[model samples]
Target: MDSLIFALNAVMPIVVMVAIGYAIKRAGFMNDTVTRAVNKMVFRFFLPAMLFLNIYEISDLADIQFGYIIYGAVATILMFLISLPLVILYTKHQDRRGPLLQSTFRSNNALIGVPLAEALCGSAGVVAAALLSAIVIPLYNVLAVISLSLFSGNGGRPNVKKMLMDILKNPLIQSIALALAILGVRVLFVKMDISFRLSDMTILFKVLRYLSNLATPMALLALGAQFEFSAIKELRREIIFGTAARTVVWPLISLGIAYFFFRDTFTAAQFAVLISIFATPVAVSSVPMTQEMGGDVGLAGQLVVWSTLISSLSIFFSCFILRLVGIFG
Candidate 1:
């Protein structure tokens, strides 16, 4: 009951926000233009604020367990590699490979992983996952962008250096770097007091926290607003592969392998959390990014929607099963 409550406390707000976005779109309050703008603001501003604030408060990075990072990164990379062969086998049209790859491996980790970490593993979990994310995001982006270019038949090979530069210049990356610098400097030389509650600070931090919290909902709502059930049905092959690989096969593969390395420090619940995080379908932003890279927006959009809609079940079940096995600590 306690864990159940915690899960609901963490997850319900995002679900409600998604419903609100869906409702707003239905009522015509949101259109493509507004959605795009809001997405940019949330992605560029609010999300980074949230990430920096979280990382800034992390006092003990050493306790985060380096093995988790190694295991998690390796697990993610392995999953990406595994998905490629399956992509060639399942998807014949070479064009579909790019979008399918994105849908397969790039997870909505920011929106889903963070909250679950906070709820279940406490601050340590958030800190660990946040650290893992710093490594994951840039890697995911490079692979995703390259796959997007290839599968879209956009003849030019993605310039690795350019992609790295863009990833480094990304606002979120800048914020994470700043936060880490603060954390490192504080750990080394300064003895700062955590005497002030965030509330004790000016309303600025307060507003920042609230606004940062808004990222998940805003992202989810934007996703809901773009949902297209008909398109998902139309592109049944892509949808099936995307949904199956993300929600089932890849996650299981990740957990099975990750557990081998992280068995001692990471509980079954933690493994469950990792599985759930990776199990989430495509990132909602994949649509725009795919289109930007010349992939099929309609198919990408449909896959994102279908993945998000089905993820709730996959995540809940994976968590529940892991709990039953006493693996999730």
Candidate 2:
């Protein structure tokens, strides 16, 4: 019962916000164009602002839990490596091969992960998730490019140039860079015998705080607006395989290893970060990337919708398991 409450408390807010977005869209208050624009704003601007402020508030990088970063990076690469061959083995439809592979490895860590971190562990959890962004975001993007580029055109070689360019232009990476620059400036200020931190009165603080507060709600709303179910009947196989792999099989294996084998090594917050990595839904970005790269856009969208729909149950069960074992206090 305690674990159920904790899991529900952590997950329901996100689900409710998404429901509100769906309701608003169904009522015609916001159309596809408007909802899409909001999604873009949340991804490119609001979410980055949220991440920057979260990381920038940290006093020193030394205090960050590096194990969480390492754990997330390792888990991501393994998922990518393991899932690719398995997806190829399972599917004869090459159009869906890339999207299926992409969905298997790429979870919605930014929109869903950060909020989950905040819910379970508060500010400390946010910082752990933020630190993880530095390692996993770039890894996910590079792998996304690789996955799509490989099957984009008769399975030609991956475009390393495009991958590099995409990494450079990633808004999350850009935000992290800006935050690191700010951290450096803070260090310089310390050496110069001056003290400054973002305060409530400062315009930058006020603006960024407002934007940060909006990131999750806007993201969940945009997710709701984009949700679709009509294609489910046709793409049943992709939906089942993708949702199962993304939300169930992979998480169970990885989390079991982390819990039983590495229990003594990673902290509870670190375990929570791992949960975000392994438990969240397939990333929404996979849908657009699949379309742009000439894959099966229908299958990709279905994967996103179905995975997002059931990921909450996965997350709740994962949290319950961890709490039952006393991994979280």
Candidate 3:
């Protein structure tokens, strides 16, 4: 019951915020142009700030368990590889492929995963999830850029050079890389007994925090404003497929493998972090990203909405079953 409540609590605010955005849109507060601009701002600015901070705030890089990180990264890449062919075969529409592919592997880890981790395994889980994020989130963005660019309508033949360039120019990727470089410098500073750190620059950090804070809510609002009820019928197949893959199949495979294979090797908190990564909903950021990248935004938005709704049950069952089996006690 606590797990169920925690699941609901983690998910409801996102639903409510999206509903509020839809309400305001219905009341004539937002239009297509404004929503498009909001998505652009989110993709280019707010989200990058959020990603940077997520990486930069890791207390110590040396403490990370690379084995856990390697598993998470490998799992993510395998999901992407597994989903790519499936998505291509599932949909004939060029623009729909990227977003559908993204829905399979990229989760709302930063927004939901950390808190869910804490709920499952306390502060230790939070630390594990955060450390995982330092790797997984950047990988998510890198792959998203690739997938979205590859399928963004190039006569069904992707321009490999342009795709590579897009990955390089991706704001999310750039921010994450910069954060890692700074983190490396900070580590060196610590070794040298230097006290300087980016956090010490209070005003700049505060500005970044302000942007970081805006990323989720504002993106949800933009998603809501552009969300169309009629599109649900048009996108019903994609929505159902994406949601089921994200909230059900992906978790079952990832968590099942972890349980049956690595039970003795991984800590409970590590399992919790895996749950946070694989069991969560499709990321809200996918909407903005799809919109920016010319993927089917309607389908992207629907996937986010439907997956988020379904993932509550997924999360609850995952926790309950894992606990029942003595995996998360």
Candidate 4:
């Protein structure tokens, strides 16, 4: 009952917040321009700040189990590979392949994973989810961008140099770098107290802390705002496939691998959190990435909405199943 309540408390409010975005947008309180601008602020500035602060606050990087991160990375790559086969064998729309794979495997770990973990498992879960985000962001972005651009018959291939440069410039990537740097310093000089004399560091800390706190609500709202009934109607097939792959197929695969292979190794909470991360739909921001890469933005948006709407069940069920298996019992 406690777990059920935790799930409801964490998920219900996020769903409502998203609905609020859609409602506000529909009511003309926030125009498209304003919506987009606010999203940028949230994404480029606020979200990165939040990630940096969370990662930086932890003095010990060595304790972060790289095994799980490696497991997640391998599973993500495997899912991507699985998509390639499906795209070639099943998908008739060659152009849709990139966007489909992107939605299917890449998760909204930062927006959905963190808050849900915090709600269900407290700060440790939040920190674990954050580490996953730090690993995933760059991998997902570069691969998705390149794949989408290549398949969409775009004018040219995505330049590797440009992509790397963009990754370097990305605020999330910057935060990850800073966080790792702090971790590195800590690991190198054990028991050494790290302090900063730079005035800029203090300002960055304050700004990031505030933004990090806002991340959960703002991201959920943005996710909700992007929901469109018309998009759902237009891209029904993509929506179904994307949502299924995200909220069901992906989590099942992750759980199977973690349980049967790494049985009794990962704690119940960790496994549950990982599966929950996989269960999350595509991020709200994937719309723009789709648009830029010649993929179908409408389809991406529809998938995000559909998958997110359905994920509560997937997460709850995964946890229930784990409990049955005596993992969480």
> Which residue ranges in model 2 land beyond 4 Å of their true spot?
63-65, 91-99, 111-127, 151-156, 198-201, 283-301
Clashes of each: 5, 0, 0, 1
Score each candidate by Cα lDDT: 0.68, 0.76, 0.92, 0.68
- Local accuracy of candidate 3 as per-residue lDDT tens digits, 207-309: 9999999999999999889889989888888888899999999999999998998989889999999999999999988888888788899899999999999
User: Which 10 consecutive positions of candidate 3 have the poorest summed lDDT?
Assistant: 60-69
| Ten contiguous residues minimizing lDDT sum, candidate 1 | 190-199
Tens-digit lDDT track for model 2 on 163-233? 67756776766787888788889888888999887673599898999999887677667767766667678
Candidate 4 C-alpha lDDT tens digits along 1-329: 66566555645665678789888878877766765566677667676676676566653355777777788887888888778767555466766677877887778775667777666567777667777766776567656655565566634344667656655666656766877687666555555665542224787667667887876566556555666786666567777788898888888888877889886577655765686567776765565556544676556767766676677777777777777787765
Total backbone collisions, model 3:
0
State which candidate has the highest TM-score: 3
RMSD each, Å: 4.0, 3.4, 0.9, 3.3
Worst 10 residues of 2 by lDDT: 2-11
Ranking by TM-score: 3, 4, 2, 1
Better of 2 and 4 by lDDT: 2
Task: Note the residue pairs that clash in candidate 4.
Answer: 18-224
By lDDT, the best candidate is 3
